[model samples]
Target: MDRFLSNTVSRIDAKGRVSVPAHFRAVVQKRGYSELYALRCLDLPAMDVGGLDLLDRYEQRIAQEDPFLQTADDMSFFCHGDGTFLKLDQDGRITMTDFIREHTGISAEVAFVGRGNFFQIWE
Candidate 1:
């Protein structure tokens, strides 16, 4: 697994675009992914970032859990949705849309924290 490992702070441009850390970009590309998926975190005021494979692994785990298990509804409805997909530009940056920006309260800058299999972008 090409895990994202590191912590980096990036400046958000006026247009709401931020350059992904070089290490993170390299890991994603090495895993054969050209795009990234993200969502407003369910329990936290941050953005959850990952690739398709991470989402797949997540769904696979959820599939085995009992439907009535604790927090299952929250996971199935709130946290689990078709995440916003953004293509990496030539410079390895992704522009956050208004919806994402508003939900995350992200403004002039952000902290990108690696979480092994994924990462989180915080205001």
Candidate 2:
């Protein structure tokens, strides 16, 4: 069974780069997520979720609910930007862009929340 794990906090550097927590990186690697998919949140109340293959299941959910309209809106909001495929450095750090940093307001202290298939970064 897939489960979400939350036990780590990451620090965002001045350049918008953060080291993926060791435990979280292990989970991501175990799930075969070498490349991550990232985008800004469309739902104002929703959290800023990230990580690899996160959209697959979400897309399925949207398709099941409103295949035409809701899905289109989701695509328009989250899929419009160039989705970043993040690669972990030797030290397990993933760099965030200025745009993402500003959008999410992520500073020195950040939360790495595991949400089953993907994870979210919260400030």
Candidate 3:
């Protein structure tokens, strides 16, 4: 129950806010995350959404690589520099950023696909 599971589709409101699935929100709340981190997937047309643990994992992976390598810089830039912090509103919703919309191509609706520790945003 503490994991993001299953999938759901939600409509974006006039203000460009989309409700996070209740179950996914519960998982995030359980982990004491005030905001979710989102990064554009390097190999897919989706956005990876998760909490601090997810960010930590990426940091750990990046730390294992040689700092001088271009791959390390690319990963750090994509995962940290370009990441978006999504703060849930009082209604458990988040306004979609232009970065998210541009990366995911989400229009009026967005699909939330859970992936254990995280979820993916798809158009």
Candidate 4:
């Protein structure tokens, strides 16, 4: 079973901050992760989030390809360039950046869904 599982909806405060679920936070902490790597999912108007394991796997996938390859370049830019690191506050809340909040169209409420090794936040 995946460490991060289940779906929950969280409220976004006026500052665009939302609480990461306690279970998810625990899972991340157990994995020795202090932050969440997030990116605007290209295929969906949502935020894709991952811990260290997912980021490591992503790096491994990219490393298998030649640096000059188009696919590699695209993955590097999409994963590294646009990736945003969010450090959870004492209450397990992260303040979303304005750019990402606008990009995902998330306003007052957001839906958090578990996706095996990762999770996603939807408007």
Candidate 5:
């Protein structure tokens, strides 16, 4: 399996599209991830993910062991949001929705951070 890794910063355009730093994209592609999953980060306010299934599975595991009432807050923040399925364009750019942009505090400056099996977008 391939690991996600980042070494550069990227810029997000007015259209909410951000260029995936070349090195990062290469690593993602090598991992067989043509598409990325994005959702707001609960702990880190300005961070979002690019691997939904992995996150979903993690959430499911927690939900199974924890009471719904106890985990409600986290569920609302992590699972109930509008998760986006982002496809990397030919130019190595992905379109972020306004909601996602706002959630991650993404302006013109963006950071692409790798997290083993996925990546995070930070402002």
Candidate 6:
């Protein structure tokens, strides 16, 4: 399928790298994305992880709002300011940096829960 489906639990190595599930990697590749964009969830102890399309969608929504309003700036701050790019290595792994760890509370392990076009990283 072209969408992220199912879930996977992966262990983090000493370098804080963890393999993105093969199925998820395939979906990402099929969508022509070279890296993943991860945004910390506003109300949850998790991260909303996806590709460029996801980030673009957020931008599109922000564009629909009036730029002079505080709401637009707030949305931009939450979606872009709190987001980070995750690059997949040769082994389809990504480093869980402080941006992710602090938001998800993920330490030795992480739970990758698929959410259709995107997925979430949880502790």
Stretches > 4 Å off in candidate 3: none
Preferred candidate (lDDT higher): 2 or 6 = 6
- Arranged by TM-score with the best first, the candidates are 3, 6, 4, 1, 5, 2
Candidate 4, residues 1-115, lDDT tens digits: the string is 3377999999988777999988888878877888889877878999888886767777899999999989999988887887788899998898878767787888888888888
Count of backbone collisions within predicted model 6: 0
Model 5, 1-123: lDDT tens per residue?
Answer: 366675467777877788987777777777677687777676785555555566666577666754556575556565655576778889888886777677877778778888776678887
RMSD, every candidate, angstroms: 2.5, 3.2, 0.8, 1.6, 2.8, 0.9
lDDT of 6 at 101: 88
Local lDDT at 8 for model 5: 61
Cα lDDT of model 1 by residue, 1-123, tens digit? 478898999998877789999999988888888788887777877878888876776677778888888766656664466368878899888897776778888878888999898888888
Between candidates 1 and 2, the one scoring higher on TM-score is 1
In model 6, where do residues sit more than 4 Å from their true spots?
none
Best by TM-score: 3
CA shift of 101, model 4, Å: 1.2
| Model 5 per-residue lDDT at 2 | 68
* Distance from true location, Cα of 36 in model 5, Å: 0.9
**Looking at model 3, which ten-residue stretch has the lowest summed lDDT?**
36-45
Tens digits of lDDT, candidate 6, 1-123: 999999989999999999999999999999999889999887899999999888888999999999999999999998978799999999999999997888788999999999999999999
Each model's lDDT comes to 0.81, 0.65, 0.92, 0.84, 0.71, 0.92
Q: Please identify which of the two predictions, 5 or 6, would achieve the higher lDDT against the true structure.
A: 6
Compose the digit string of candidate 2's lDDT tens values, residues 46-105: 244455456675565555665468656766456545355667887788787666567767
lDDT of 6: 0.92
Worst 10 residues of 4 by lDDT: 50-59
- Candidate ranking under lDDT, highest first, comes to 6, 3, 4, 1, 5, 2
Task: Write the number of the candidate with greater lDDT, choosing between 4 and 5.
Answer: 4
TM-score of 6: 0.96
Candidate 3: tens digits of C-alpha lDDT, residues 7-101: 99999999999999999989998989989999888777899999878889999999999999999999899888999999999999998889999
Higher TM-score: candidate 3 or 4? 3
Q: What TM-score, over all chains together, does every model reach? A: 0.83, 0.72, 0.97, 0.90, 0.75, 0.96
- Candidate 1 achieves a global lDDT of 0.81
